[model samples]
Target: IATRGLVDLPIDVLIRIAVRLPRVEAVARLACTCRDLHSPAFFEAAMRERTARRGGEVPLPSGRRRRETMVQALCRGERRDRFQRQNKIAAGDYHSVFVSEEGRLMTCGTHSFRDNPQPILGHSELDDEDLQVIGGDSVLVVPRPVAGLADVRVRTVATGYAHTLAVSEAGAVYSFGLGESGGLGHGNEADQHTPRVIESLRGVRAVAASGGLNHSLVLSAAGEVYSFGAGDRGQIGHDPESLFVPSRDRQEVTERLQLTPRVIDSLQGVRVVAVAAGAYHSLLLSEAQHVYSLGGGGATRRSSSRGRTSRFTGPQWTPQINEALRKVNVVAVSGGLGYSLVLSEQRHVYAFGNGSHGELGNGRDHSSTLYEFTSDGLQQINARIRAQQRALATTDAFGRHGYEVFRHSMTLADEAVPRLIESLGGVRVVGISAGGSMQTGGTGHSLVLSDEGEVYSFGCNGYGELGRNFDNESEELPTSVPHVVETLRGTRVVEIAAGGASSLAATATGAAYGWGRSECTGLREQVGERKSATPLRFADLELAHG
Candidate 1:
């Protein structure tokens, strides 16, 4: 028998050897050793073996297209194979989190007080070096396992303006990060740098949880609701009396803050199946298919029968039934800063509240010049102007107010109550997400995923959050995310998420894509471009795991 060197072996035999390599890196090194082993057929066979290891099929190249390598590196040099094991993902104002199959938690993006806190120029007077070392500001461009949470098995995760919440497989809740306004639900306003279980919920098994701008909601397995944090706007679902006792002389009611979880008495016997939180509002969907809304009521100034300004309107302090949606069999609900969306079993969609930026998808022409100013209309307009002034004074002090001014100038004909979004009548919507901070007057946006794996977006596109290639102009009606739909033509979208100014989508094949504002989270650089006008493949995402 003649002994032959490895490089002299036939391409087919060398490919078989390469496929047996334990790691993709190992196969790459083997290919580098011999020109014959570096052939496309060899790499393709190796890729097929890796796909089989990940429990997925390696899609054959279509037409003249070749099979591109599915594996890529994350920004921080972490392999995409590591991210393929994640089961869930969530995004906050400036950060994102992922949970692995083994329950390991990984986080990335800017988790700094400077990025998430309300813009207060003098909140910290530390020097640059001190701010970097002691201000609790940090950035992780690459996914890194959350420190001290190695042993805990996280089942799901949720993010808010400046904090994060994770539920364990054992039904225990863990909270961390900015704790201002009692958002941490720790019974005190103290920031938690590490994962800490909420002692009060030790005996209660939480099935679902949501985090808002400054509040949190937890749903128990028995359909009970628990809330804590800023209740000034009645987002906590407390009784109006408990929030504030109206006085004859005080024009402004002192907003109440809750530091610990409290049961929503109004929904004691109601079986709430799902809960969603906005900047200052909460939405609940019950087992009977009824929907309820709370908070954002105190912001509307209405004249009472006695001619005094009735600050409390509709359902602000209590979990009142949404009368407009009483006739619809609501199966899903999503809440934004100033609006809410509901999906019926029939796939019909309904929206309510502010639609100045077309967040409602009602197709109302906001640019019409027709003017009609009645006494009541004038009062409403004046109130809105006052509110806008206050918002500008605090945060948008030097920002543009053109959109606000134009929106206020138009007739106030947008939906204030639940109305059917006829534009999406034929499509079956299975998922929905809303972005923008209602409390901050940011032009909000909305996204919906249909049953056919298609995505539609409306509302603000100033930063290209809509992903329609149209800049600045808001979409008053739903439009398709063409790039995403075309790129993943044959794949079914499995999950979707919307952040303050960005959107994410994941396919059944485990592929991930993202678009929109990339500054705060450093996503622009990760996508290898500075502009985020269209969806880009998360090149580092590996969908297969062995």
Candidate 2:
């Protein structure tokens, strides 16, 4: 058949030949080889067949219109194959990172050149001159491979306010960027412009890691949790005694900082399977399906008999089990600046603390309503209701009026305890992501991906982070972002992430979509800009075909 005139073959035979080719690019290139075989119908059929075989939408051969693959739909503006190799994505307050299927890493967003000043250094065989800084001081508007890590096979990445951490396949952790407050786990308060291995964790195999504004957490293969960085608010999980000694002056530990990684002995016995970090708190999920929380007074505050707020303190501080989460086994957890979310074994989601921006997803705004009623006002309302009840005909009237008053009073109250997000009931939530913080001046938001491949976002949409089109408003209930749903209609969302005021979703086909806060680097626009509330497909990278 090769020796014969290939163009003379039957259309059916030609399609079979094209289908057998190893790559879509190959088939595309073949279509351009000769006019005899150049048929729009043939090309379209070949692409449709290839897409169908790869689990993509396939149109009917007769009368039905074809559906676009997530890739095709997202690659509209500029046609490039860079996104074809992306497998995972992480977003930070002002930057984003992408991990390719082959372990290559690419980053976009805000990065400082003042620290390094020099070109990025690495062990790649390529010459130093080859690794030049494209644009100095300007925000990286597109995803570009990090030079120094060219040889490092990155498995996952986590971004902080202004820093980045990457875990390699061998469990080696590399950190870079703002090291202030020790968020880099490098045992020093020095900024790093190039990727540097955290010498303290050199031999320790880290299975997972997360970064907060001024702190970092790493989970080892042995299930131990190591934390480093600022501990002023106990974000480092160190014992209070170790951090400050008894003093008659009773001075506050104003310089509370951990310059190196320290293991949290309190978690020694528990086999932690996952870890998450907020701006000032940390969450751990153990193998036994128990959730543990440490640090930050906002999320875990106890009112003492004296009516003063007391916080849990210690090195290996006894982690508080979210008491509101009883009977339900938690499988995953995420934290925002002052709020937390946990996914139960049954896929039910429970949220606690700070509903200020509706991050709690409980249909209330605590920021504006928390102080609406003072103690005196509540007493006055109770007195008026009691007086009114005395004049009522039956006790039922008082009961109904009292219930209404109670409901109204609690409407805007902060969820100091875990409360089931009733709006998400009946939807089997498989994953949860929370974003924004005081550090970034973001209103904060939350996102959850359902088992049915749908994503629901709520909370602050001030910058269109929720992908809801409208901005400056908040959604107290979980609402689906119609544009995102319609854009990637047939794709299954495998993972979801939330940044300062941005959201990202990765599909089963390795397609990645990002929306909100254009400064995060995932968007094509410049810093301080905003994009459509709908997710824009990443044009730089895509998952490589199997």
Candidate 3:
């Protein structure tokens, strides 16, 4: 293998062929060719005799971890063997990147440059460019797809902080690039990298678009949910500078700037499936499994004896329904930058806001919001002593099923409600996701997703995204990556999503997996800063391999 000699092997087979070689930056340039294997005590006695002959673990040989998980399984098999390429890509450090698949739109990267990745300017499948104009370019840029919106087929895509939302397949809705506070609804504050069409929505089956350093959220498909750019901390419930809108019939609409699309009248029939956007606040998920919140009314509650005060602020124009979730049915909702999470369908999980770095798995501290009264505080005190001895007869009789919650975070200050992530006890949680990976030494974390797709990480692995390989260090809490994904262990994982730092999983045989921090998840040139990831498969699905 490499001309027979090369140090005549057997240093525990050269540390299992040097931990699957090639990386460690081409083996530190192949140990600087000589000087007795580049000093440093022969590379610390070959990692202390290969961590004392693997007791610390380093086996490979599952055909070399399937050829090093084939570089993210050949980039998800060439993005599902091309036909249109682009499976999914996300970014928010302003490095943009909102790519979706097959029936596309595209943008390149450049939140603030880090050496070449440029490919913006698109959207024009023709018809006199009816709706094109993607984005400008930034480093290495590579997005490219949007040409007149290729019949606007799209499946799902969301991005805020410069506007961009697409969700068509009859569920029609579209917008492109910046619209100031109106976030591109087209009525005023101008800016449109070209898609358009939000004709006040039509039937809207399912959609989610989010934002907060300004304001934005768009949830529809009957369950109603909507908001438009910057509402100060009212997060768009209205009145901080007018972009005011709130009327799925709940009607509030004022101060002017809704540029378009309105409906959230306190979520009428409720239906909403999912919607998350924070930096101020906004989260919604209800199919009966309720969870409705609206922008940082001063970040919510906190008295620990008056160290913080908004007097547990309230009234961001209204839409608060969290009363510690009545009976728990909500099924999936997420948000970041300030904190929020809810996933229930008996997979129970609830976290109010700001648990600092613990991201609300409830390790305590760091301001909590106003949804307290945690997870049925002992099943609501045992359903009020079984309804005062009438012996409670089935409201699902204290129903408690496969509880689960994937990932979360909130504390930047102010929290009054929401908290029930009891440190993941009983482990049935399906999936929760968060982001902002890579910042080692300074600590800046967030990443969670489980349903056995396993991958729990706590804030800022610096860049290793808490994959735990020690790229620097920063994990204030939440760290479960005990490696049982033996290529997705017993299968399951229906879906999962995360960003800011990166994490993803999908199964039930559709196959998809991800690691952390690197161009968010285009795999920064195939696994460069994945601090602790192991489930790197990325997709090969036709459903067979267990």
Q: Which candidate is the best by TM-score?
A: 2
Error of 2 at 69 (Å): 46
Give the winner by lDDT. Answer: 2
What is the alpha-carbon lDDT for the whole of candidate 3? 0.46
Better of 2 and 3 by TM-score: 2
The per-model lDDT (C-alpha) reads 0.60, 0.62, 0.46
| Candidate 3 minimal-lDDT segment of 10 residues | 395-404
Per-residue accuracy of model 3 over 1-546 as CA lDDT, tens digit each? 458766665555655665555344444455566556655444444544433342222222221223443333222222211111112433443333433434455543332233322212323222322221212212322344566567877656666534567766566767766566576565666666567776666555544565543456776544467776655445556554444543345433232345565665655545554677755567665543345676552233322322332244433555556755655555566666556666665565666554434445555332222222357553563464334321111111010111111012123322455545666656666556543321221122344456555545554333444454442322323332222234445766555544554455555555555554444333442423322344454322221112
Sorted on TM-score, highest at the top, how do the candidates line up? 2, 1, 3
Per-residue alpha-carbon lDDT of model 2 for 1-546, expressed as tens digits?
A: 357777777778888888788876677688878875556556666666665554333322211214644333222101111111222677777677778767777776654353433111111223333222323333455567788788999877787767788888899989887777778877777887779999989899976788887788887866678888877666667875575322236443354677778898776556665788877678886654556787653444432333333332222245655545634567678877656788876778887755555677777653233323678975665465344321111111011123223322322424656778888877877778877634333356788888778888877665567776543433322232212345445768878888887788887777778887665643634434444476788785774222
The pairs that clash in candidate 1 are none
**What TM-score should be assigned to candidate 3?**
0.31
| TM-score winner, 1 or 2 | 2
Instruction: Give the residue spans of candidate 3 off by over 4 A.
Output: 1-148, 151-156, 159-164, 167-184, 188-233, 236-294, 298-310, 314-333, 336-339, 342-350, 353-420, 425-448, 454-489, 492-494, 497-505, 508-546
